[model samples]
Target: MRRFASRGGIDTERGAPMSKTEDESGTNAQERGDGSSQSSVAAGRAFGKAVLRDARRGAALGAGALQRGGRLLWSRLAAKTTKSERRASPARSPAPRGPESGAPASPPFGRRRLRRLMGAALLSLPVIIALSAAMAHILLPNLEEMGARAEDRQVFEDAHGAPLIIRGAVPSAYAPLDTFPRHLVDAVIAIEDRRFFQHGGIDIEAIARALLRNIRSGGIAEGGSTLTQQLVKISYLAPERSLSRKLHEAILTRQLERRDSKEQILEAYLNSVYLGSGATGVPAAARIYFDSAPEDVTLAQSAALAAMIQAPSVVNPLADLEALRARGALVLDAMEAQGRIDADEAGQARDEMAALVPRPPAIRYGTWFSDWITRSAETLAPAPRGVSLLRTTLEPDLQVAAERIIEQHLAAAGSGAQAALVALRPDGAVAAMVGGRDYGESQFNRAVDALRQPGSTFKTIVYLAALAEGFEPGDRILDRQLDIDGYTPVNFDGRYRGEVTMLDAFAASLNAATVNMAMTVGLDRIAQTARTLGIDTELRQTPALALGASEIPLIEMTEAYGAIATGRIPFEAFGIRSASGMAGQDRIALNPVPGASGPQIDRIMAARQDMATLLRRVIDDGTGRRAALTQPAAGKTGTTQESRDALFIGWSGDLITGVWIGNDDNTPMDGVTGGGLPAQIWSEFMIVGLNLADATTVGGAKSLETTPAPAQCNVTACRRAYRSFDVSDCTFQPYSGPRKLCTR
Candidate 1:
């Protein structure tokens, strides 16, 4: 009944009719070529020509031109066809719907095209899926596991190549990854890495959630880090909480994924992560927590340890056993949710954990050597890829003796004094090292880490330098009051011996004489000699360095002296001898490497002879006389300023040892001199360490300058028996050398 033009100017009603002028269809008279119609047709043809011309003009322009051109072209085409078609076609019912009607007409392609498309899709469904899966496998795969970094422990053996123990923060044996119980692996994976098998190291979903949480909290509030990232964090990076560290972890994890197989990564992560109770890695945790190995662990036990991976200290069995078990139950539930284990198995595991009570680990055998070995392994050998087998230079019995000596002597010395010792072969193989009196009391390694002044023992290096400078031990040097550059040095007695042969001065450890010697031989040269001899610790080139003012490490000091005792070819102070994987596949030989070329053998021997006299005098009648052993050994005693540090460094042909005794608090020790306790310890160690005959022939540096005791006579046996200061001494007058006789 009503009709109207809508927004688009289209008639809204179906039955609407237009006036004859609006219809645009020609009037019947015009079609019949009436005079008026003929004029209209000519006008229409002109209009068509004008539209065509406009379209051509528009087509020459850009984007706007294209739109205009298309619109003009369509309009022109429609004008030509609209009237002709309306008159020629039969009448048809109009569409029932309009713009107002929600039921719009079907797409022009309509139901037929849709049906064909559906049929094609149905027919090729399998093929499409197959190709998609193939592409996914080439790229992402179905959570295929890449390899993980292997956390291998270092194994240390005794001198005879027998395994002493595994040396690492964690002390545990290697167990094959695949052999680990399925439940154990499952529990670990469920708690530590739920999508372990699903993700390619980085989890975008978890990261997004973590980022959101972090933004909400205005700080790092959550970690979406995967197990692989955790491995990289603990192994190569510090545990600092930072965005950069997280980024590094993410990158390292991706690399690990690309380099390792999935099973390998999981195994490595499981083995290396710190679990709890002073343990590092899984095997260690197993031993420390359950007193069992990884493979032997039950399902409940596995879950219990797995729970600690997130907050080891919080769920620590040592601190909170119940919490540990409770967390373990949660792991089982997670597994059940993932259908990794049945509900029945989860319930059974829960019961098992409830019934079990783990005991606190009773740690045993805390030795400084073990601690040192643990740290040394970082450089001596690569972490074991499978199982580490290390051969060390340790003499087990000697190590025991060193430990016992420290303990026994420290107790006897009394008064909170601490002692450290280091013993090595002439070639620089460390045989025995004691870092402190008791490792249980403290883990500080005094032998290598401490930097106490060497006192007079430093004179050994000074004397060595002097020998290099063409000064003979028997050559006389003035020890009278001398001042150099506003600094004055005195003997231990605070008095100067006017003039003594270099031999006697060194033997007596006269501070003034030693400083004079150091001055005679350039301070720089002395420092250089110390370094060249194997002392890697920094040294001062000042004159005070002569009197041992610059602090140094005992191990390095011993190492330096060991080079001399071995006749001056440079060698490193080393403990590791060789290493191999448990399977014996990757063997790494850690043999000694020469440091630098040294003095010729003849020169070293000659210098040794000169110092040999000096070393003998000290043990004979000088400061170190109290340290005299029945064997032939030479050493110097050192007493620091204010008796703060006392040291004795001595050697035979086979070994060199350094002993230090002092108050850890640096309080004076009842005027303890290096000759006292240090010398005594050195003597005691050598007695057990060397054969009696070998000891006698040890310090032959100056053997040519001294004659052997006459087997037939003392100064007495020649005429009548008489005694010298030495009860066992068979004294003859001083002899020049092997061919020269003693002159009275």
Candidate 2:
């Protein structure tokens, strides 16, 4: 024991040396000035001495082994050579030099070779380290902007510049730094980036593990990204799957760690992550999926989001059920392992999440109305992103009623026929729109896009222009076959009812009577009246334009009628009322600009009232009789040649509506007329639009004289006789003498 103690460099005191434990306790070791025992001091000294001794002994033994092995092989070769030489020259003998000459017979290979090999190994270490560091730094990309970009905000609004109520977006109060729950953070980290808290942005241990697994599995089943690295990858880097991109992501992640706190980085990461559908960020995702805030999410919902992160489309609840459940189960297992929930709770959460029903898809109601809304809103702000909320003058109840009426009428008309309806308020504010059967199927809004002839619905403008030309309702006009130059105009039935008053001719839509009136009233004056009523499209200068030869869209026609409804005060129709900047801070109020507002409703009121009186007469007893109602109303019915276009435009004290039914290809409808389906639609819509209001006329409407006057006139008779020279031999005034001779 004493010999062993001395060999170990231990003191041989009164008894045997202290034990290893006692020495470690520092009772037999050195002490510090602060009175704490330096227990590790002896162990450290022992470890260092032992290492040195082992190293020196290993060096000596290695040297001897190499020398001995070399000598043995060299002596054997020399022996074989000498044996061959002896066989050839047996008489020769070689002797060594004498000891007095200070030369040995053999050279030593022991220490010299050891020194050379050691020097070489020592020289190579620094070069290897330098090369490795250079490659690692050069191959990676720089991604310093990822976190900053993730923290930015996005906005959404409608065409009327109104803040849109996005279907699946969480509000601001549910953001990560505020209302987002801490468990969500844990679940994401646990499943996506374990060891996130311990790593310095890039997890080397995880990378090596992932590499080994991939090589063994022969596929990329795992991603070796820290959460910080993922944030850099998603926000700054393109989603290219390559080693070079991964290296760049790692390099940027390290840099990000140096610039931002872990919490700040995490906040940005969660906020920017997409949860699928149309949602772009976490708040948006939360709102879309749960219809709730982030903090309000249950464990099952959290698991659903976590599952979606693996493959958002494949596991989307809105997509596949079985796949989503299987994916969600994987997330639950991860959560359980992370101690976020117990195993039983995790399983229960997964089951519950699988059974949850997804929310409905978004609704895009008021298709045509939304288009007008967009246009009117565009006048205030050029784009939806620039404005906040737009307050519209829409009466929702009235708009709904109008849509319902049109929908019911079309349903009654049955399929294979499409219709578009537009309703406007007295002030020229569009209230409702129904473009087609489905907004999703076709966004091509017909109310504002389809251009068709106004048909006889345009006669009111011609009559009003005649009234303006000092032609009274009782003025003598002829309904005989007429001729103008080489064109002969015939009545709708191809037969003339000779000698009719202006009121009777307009009320019955008599083609010859209107032709004569167009000549007497001047076609230019009629076109001007149409323009003043808000028909902006060009009308032909010829008297043929007096009939409904011009084509107009529903929106333009509605605006024109809207002027007459408001007593001829032409106000430009607008959808948006106001706008604001981001977060509702910077507000810019918009009003109707000039030039869009045209003739005062009062100036044209008398003429419009006169025309309306005649039009109501038409609905009550003339061509538009099919559209006549028990209630007092003013309206016109129009049908194009070959029954191609049918129209009914009318207004009550409450609303003005236009209904058009025809083939989109301009093919004539099967037996359809202005008085048939279109009138039905107009009457139905007005009934609901007026909503039980008593039938009444505009209290101060101008009245046409209630009389029957001169039925035959010289000018009209002579014009018709010359106009029918080609199509008809019958003159305006029948001749008692013979054919082809005018008896005036």
Candidate 3:
């Protein structure tokens, strides 16, 4: 009844009807504008919408190009389809019949047509032959290069930074080209890829057979990839389990065969193949599982490696020895079928391999030293980024000795107690570094890490400072309790021995006397003295520091003690000498510095001389006397307040050692003093390191120059006595002198 746009609707621009129905009705209404202009407007609107739709489609297509290209390239690269299968089907050929039986002799086609067909077939034969020759000469090399690049390779090294001790890898005996055990290779080809040699790379018949087997099994029970195709996949492609990936692998395999020699391709495949247990190559795998070289590997071993390649992680010898053996036997069967080995050889190899001794748990013997050396080597001569080997100076003997000493002593001390020891040469080169008893169980290197109070060991530095202050060892000093400006310091026993000589005070570790001496020289001077002697630890500016209140690591302590033994020169502790990359089958030295880093001229040399004398007195008469067994040794015993930390530092002129015994948690032990376990460990390691040499050969106090002393305190003693010159009064004074006195 009511329509908005009726037959008389008009266009504002053209003043015309918008539709045919409107145009006819518009004659009676209005026609003041151009009807052609209205048609143009509608056509332009349609064109704009089409342009927008096309732009949207173009954007989407551009976005998907990269992903689609990648997929296409991958498929082309794989190309697993066989040319024979892709060829025209013979079944599609016309059926043949007996001569003149059911079909006409020539089927109405003239001899001329037949002749033309024959001529076409005859002409194609030469072309096909020529094309094959061109492929053999041109395309083959390119394919081989692709396959070679696809194979995998691995590199590694030893603790000494020696070249890799490869597993499944063929040895130098088979070097230049991998020469597999003839039997092993034969068996693999027979069981796994029978047409391996005959085919350029991909095996069509094998692939067809595998496809049938897989379909029957309803799963991937058999792989269709030929050895070459597998090599192509392993070497050049991501190991994705997709049909496209397999297709690319087949193409690459064909390309590889055409380009490379059979021997070269096969060798690369064998060498690069994974054999489980983190072993990427056959040589590495052989050594890992059988502790044998690749050439020396038996058929069973070869079979094992071969089987491992199928599913390395599943057939890993380290994880499942039985499965590995079973897989290996299968490999052997392949080798036997391939005529690579005789039945007898295979059987014997199988039995011998099965009887191989299982690998033992890793030693992890020098875990602490290994880790420390590893870090040190990194700093000394850092490897390139992504490098795995680190050169180090870790002597097996030193490691063994340090470990045995730690194990024996810690076990003897029981589990509750902890100890640290560092043995170094006089030049500061570390011989053995034992952080704790079981470095393997605990990785903390207490030798270089833990900081504990030095106790009496700190006394040596105080005395050295005193010596630098012109104090003589033989000079007399009062060890009795005395007030220093009203601040009285007592001995360890809280009792003072009256009027003892300086040597006696030091020998007895007289705390009051040492404090008095330190005060006389000034605390700052003593701290500076310790610093010069290689003690970089923080020192408290208190009188207690005179008796080792400051804590230091055992390595620093030994190194300082070693400097003292060196008689004034500070030597940095180092293990590695130098390292160089391999050249001509030998490692060359990178640097020729004969010594570790330290002060050039020892500023604290004289102090070290005095320390030697004082420490010798400690072993001869004081707390460390027990440390001297068969030779004259010099050492200092240290125990902190409440006996929370115990330390003993000693040297036999050849080796300087320091030992610390305390709980890692810093909880005090029951009656475990430095003179107990620490001293014993020091003694044990020192004896082994020293070799019972004559002590005189090393720098001893006997070589030190004796100093003249002031007898001011001595003269004070005779001041109270009767003097002839001071006798002003002529009183006999009881004449209590020795017989024949001046009174007569």
Candidate 4:
């Protein structure tokens, strides 16, 4: 048992040891596994608890930040309230947060709160901008005031109340929106603003497209302004392209859209938009282009007018017919594309346009007269509120004749010379006036504005002064070269007769003799006589004054001669007869009738009769022979130095006319004497004007019965009748009498 026990013991020991080792190893391994499992489970539980705590803290912080942001926003909004509310409310203290409340103190402007405030500011940015824009929009100009200020219309009418010209913002015939033809409206909309009705005031899509186009074209090829915007521009804004102006226009356009309906805005636009050649609206355009009413405009005409909206000056029917037709075709194509008109209608319109032949512009008769009337009306009647009808003294027929005559003479002259003619009644009423050769080429009213030397025509005043100073026409005067006060007077022909009667000296335009007579008659008396006859220009006190050296206007000079014709002193010429308007008619005050019955009137009549005899002698036997008429005519021919100015002023019956031919720059004409072109023009015009043949005179018939017959006397009897005699011809001449006698 011992051996076996030993062996058994060994075996048992080994076995038991092995078993115990195995059991112990298994136990240790099992225990170690169990401990590892427990540790892992504990670690997992700890980690999960830590994560829960962190999540809770984060949620709490987030909630706190949101609450602070809400408080801040509320405070800001509340601070914006009225100060009275702030004063009436109780002030709230910060909440108690020390030991009484189990919460930690929060720092002012913490990171989370800063972030929250930034987010709130970012959220309210668009609202702030929108509010600012609204306030700015409210502070713009008043639309109604602008519209009222832009509603001015001026329609000028001729003497017979025919529409002569239209001017200003709105035309006389302002067609309403309803009066616009359907095709016209469609054409305008298609070409100018396709989405006119769809836009409020500005079209964003259109603007973008225009911007892209402009960028591509490298210029402003398109203006994306809607109809509302265009109306605003026309009615309120100035015509300037600028960023600031565009901004204001955009704002005003929005205001207009808000204030007026689409139709009203369109009506205003159509009535005020400027279509060039002085047409301000569609009505004026229709009347001017087609000579028709706006509603009666044909489809092709409508398209053409609509095309003018883009560039009126360049593409009008008068300026460029082909350009207008091309633009009209584009407008028609656009209309067809917009479905405003079908293919057949578009084709018909195209055919009409292709068949269209532009009418030649009406001959604008009496443009200078019309312009003068317009200017005169400004002061005469002050252009009462709306349309003014100035009944002028302008006889249209006479004006037409005068224009044709002037054109003919100037064309024949062809020296780049200009002429001015002023015709007046014996009573000083301006009948016809041609200011310049072409009113379109130049606007200078030479008749009323040009101050030129009267040359020898001024001798009439000197002779009148001499006559007033008791120098009879038959008085003997030495027609020799004379020098007085360092001034020498020579005859036009540079030849002088030793002795001649005053009538012969006057008829021959003997400068030296007239100057000598002027010296004897006193220069002051001559100036006074000129003023009495209606010369308003300042006269110089010199001997040259006798030789017509005074610079005077043609109108004033003509009026002075009118005094001679009418036997009236201080005669005033007038153009406007009557100015009729919305107010009562104003009969323009004219020069009073020759009612003076004193010695002054008697002296004027005597001087006029004597001067008439001398002037008749000039036409009968002297320099003014070219100015003779079928009936009795009297005039004076005046030629300035170097032929710079040539004039012929005359009267037959109750009509007195003055003609002047000269260069605009005071350049001399090519050997043009007073008796040459000027006298011829005067004679031709007078023949037509006086209607000596089949044509009766404009104002009245010639008074042949009033003309005194020439005196018949022998040499002895004529010498006894006058203080002088023509020894060369053995003729008796009376210079200061109503009639002159020559022994034939």
Residue-by-residue lDDT tens digits, candidate 3, 289-316: 6666567766666666667777788877
Top of the candidates by TM-score: 4
TM for every model, in the order presented, reads 0.56, 0.59, 0.58, 0.64
lDDT of 1 by residue, 1-744 (tens): 212233222222321222345334545543556786556545644553454344333333334644565566556656655665577635564545756676865533334454565456455544544433322222221112222223445656666654343332345444558768888898888876778888998888878988999999999976788887777777666668643344446555776787678888877677678776667677677776776767788888888988888889788778788888888888989999989899888889989988767753443332566667767787753545645777777776677777777777767877478889988765456778888776766778899888898888888888888887788777898888788898888777788878899878887778787787778778987886776565667787888999888888888777766656555445457777778876677788775553322133234445766676678788888889877877677888888888999999887647688999877777888877888888878888877777534332222222212422112212332224222212223223323422211111
Q: Candidate 1 lDDT (Cα, whole model)?
A: 0.68
Candidate 4: stretches off by over 4 Å? 1-149, 165-232, 240-271, 277-279, 283-297, 318-323, 330-347, 362-377, 387-396, 410-414, 425-431, 438-443, 470-476, 567-606, 691-744
Q: Name the lDDT value of residue 491 in candidate 2.
A: 73
Candidate 4 backbone collisions, by pair: 473-735, 691-695
Clashes of each: 15, 9, 30, 2
CA lDDT, every model vs. true structure:
0.68, 0.62, 0.61, 0.71
Cα RMSD for candidates in order: 23.4, 23.0, 23.8, 31.5
In the range 1-744, model 4's lDDT, one tens digit per residue, is 111122322222111211234343355333567776456445644554454444334433555666777778667655554444565535564567866898886644444565677687566555544433332233234465455466544445444554454222122455558888998888898999999899898999999999999999999999887888877777788888643455468767776787778897887788777888778888788877887778888888888889999899999878988898998998899999989999988999999887666653355566666666667555643444433445566666677788898888778877578889998865456778888888778878898899999898888888888886778889999888887868888787789898899999989999988888888889987886776566778999999999888899988888777777766554566666555442445433432233222333345557788888888888999899999888888889999999999999888866788999899999989998888888988888888767634233433323532533222224554466556555444334455543322322
Show model 3 residue runs off by greater than 4 Å: 1-314, 337-340, 361-364, 382-391, 478-490, 583-603, 691-744
Candidate 2: residue 401 lDDT (0-100): 62
Task: Between candidates 1 and 2, name the one with more favorable TM-score.
Answer: 2
> How many Å off is the CA of 93 in candidate 4?
37
Ten residues in a row with the worst lDDT in model 3? 707-716
